[model samples]
Target: MMKPLPLDKVYRFIEPGPVVLVTTAQGKERPNVMAMSYHMVVDDGDPPLIACMLGPWDYSYRAFRATGECVIAVPTVDLAAKVVAIGNCSGADTDKFETFGLTPLPAKMVKAPLIGECLANFECRIKDDRPVENYNMFILEVVAAWVDPERKERRVIHHRGNGTFVVDGRVLDIRKKMTKWPTYIRD
Candidate 1:
């Protein structure tokens, strides 16, 4: 059997990905927002699927579970400080949207609102919740998506270690022929 890895050392081993704002609304009340890095896009066509992990103790976790809806907002490098701030605080105690100066945009299919300042936003509905209670994981189906045209071509911000972050860097295009396996060598 494979040995189990310790949780304390797991975060670093996982690939560092972009930080996102998870917006959730329980019932008809105002939505709550939190910053998270444990998420990824699953598909690009039609209704996209997004997978994210949330701690059971997080306020947004319960809100998402209760409402079965959320919005994932991709922030830029300029918003790193604000992202850290929101991640450090609890939505249950403070009005994060107002404090962070985040504009809430109405979503077409979900109660949760999108963050206007973000470069990209994904409105999603919970497709399954069993994983959340069992492993703090959520799978969502994107109902809608938006992006700022100006920043669409620019690099987005991503979270690194120790309160540090890296912005989107230069792009490198590789020809498919150059990506062949070693055994498939060509002259």
Candidate 2:
């Protein structure tokens, strides 16, 4: 039998992708890292774009406005607690990188530095801001991407709200019908 529950708080079902650390920087000011899951790939073409929603109150909001750039760092199961810590604290009052013991590496196309610990990083620039003024949404274009070659097993975490998390486990590859893997814009 099937069940129909209340739809008032249904974000956990619609969230796309695993939890990611969104890094934002502006000029000489201290950079910030935020644990976010409200993001997804809006355009998968050559110059891929991402749709993200951030509260106007977040420090990264101002950083993105000032720098027009940000980076999405994909974390694994190892950084679960740290991700919660990063989300619990406010970057406006503390240096997240120093607090979390994360290393920042220079990015190729944006001022926002990449997280050295993440398995993958997406460097992006603001492509559209219409959602920001209306609904606090942002559409960013991925300019550059980096990945760690050493991490053979990528076990990322996904937030399910209310102190619950789900880890990515097992892979079911059914590529029999697919011709080939898609190529990135850079390729």
Candidate 3:
């Protein structure tokens, strides 16, 4: 039997992608990081494009608007607690990198630094911001990406809305069943 759920809680059911830390900076001012999950791949080709939602209310939005660049860092399940806490605070008052003890590493293509503790980091520049007025969404083009090859833990956490979260589990190899886009499968 299906139970009725409130329409307002629908986001918890349809939330997409893993929770990521977005880093942005304006000129020589200190960089800021924001915990975000409202991002998705717009294209997976060479120089991939990503779409993320960031409204003016977010402190990082001003930096994004000023520099038009950011770094999306993917954290593993182990950093779940810190990730949630980072979102609870405001970058306007706190230096998230220092407060959270997250290491910031320089990137080759962007001014925004990458989180050393994250599993992967993608340096991106805004490709389109036409949707910002209505959706607060920006389409970004990835100029560079980095990953920790030595780190063992790889499970990523997904936000189920509110304070709840789900960690990645298990592995299923169904690549052989893929009829189309077989090239996407990796060995």
Q: Top model by TM-score, which number?
A: 3
Model 3 agreement with the true structure over 30-112: per-residue lDDT tens digits:
88999999988989999899999988888999988989899999999999999999888889999999999999999989999
lDDT of 1: 0.81
User: How close is every model to the real structure, measured as TM-score?
Assistant: 0.82, 0.91, 0.96
Regions of candidate 2 where Cα sits further than 4 Å from its true position: 178-187
Q: Write the per-residue lDDT of candidate 1 for residues 1-187, one digit (tens) a residue.
A: 8899877867755645788889988876667899888887766557778778888778888888777888888888778889999999988888999999999998887888988889888888887667776778878888888988877445566776467777788776554566656443433
Of candidates 3 and 2, the better by TM-score: 3
Evaluate model 3: give its TM-score.
0.96
TM-score preference between candidates 1 and 3, better one: 3
* lDDT by candidate, in order shown: 0.81, 0.88, 0.92
Residue 20 alpha-carbon offset, candidate 3, angstroms? 0.3
Quote the positional error of residue 132 for candidate 3 in Å. Answer: 0.6
Q: Who is ahead in lDDT, 1 or 2?
A: 2
Tens-digit lDDT string for candidate 2 (1-187)? 9688678658767667689999998889988999888888888876999999888788788888888899999999999999999988898899999999999999999999899999999999999999888878899999999999899758999888755799998877656545565343123
Which rank order by lDDT, best down to worst?
3, 2, 1
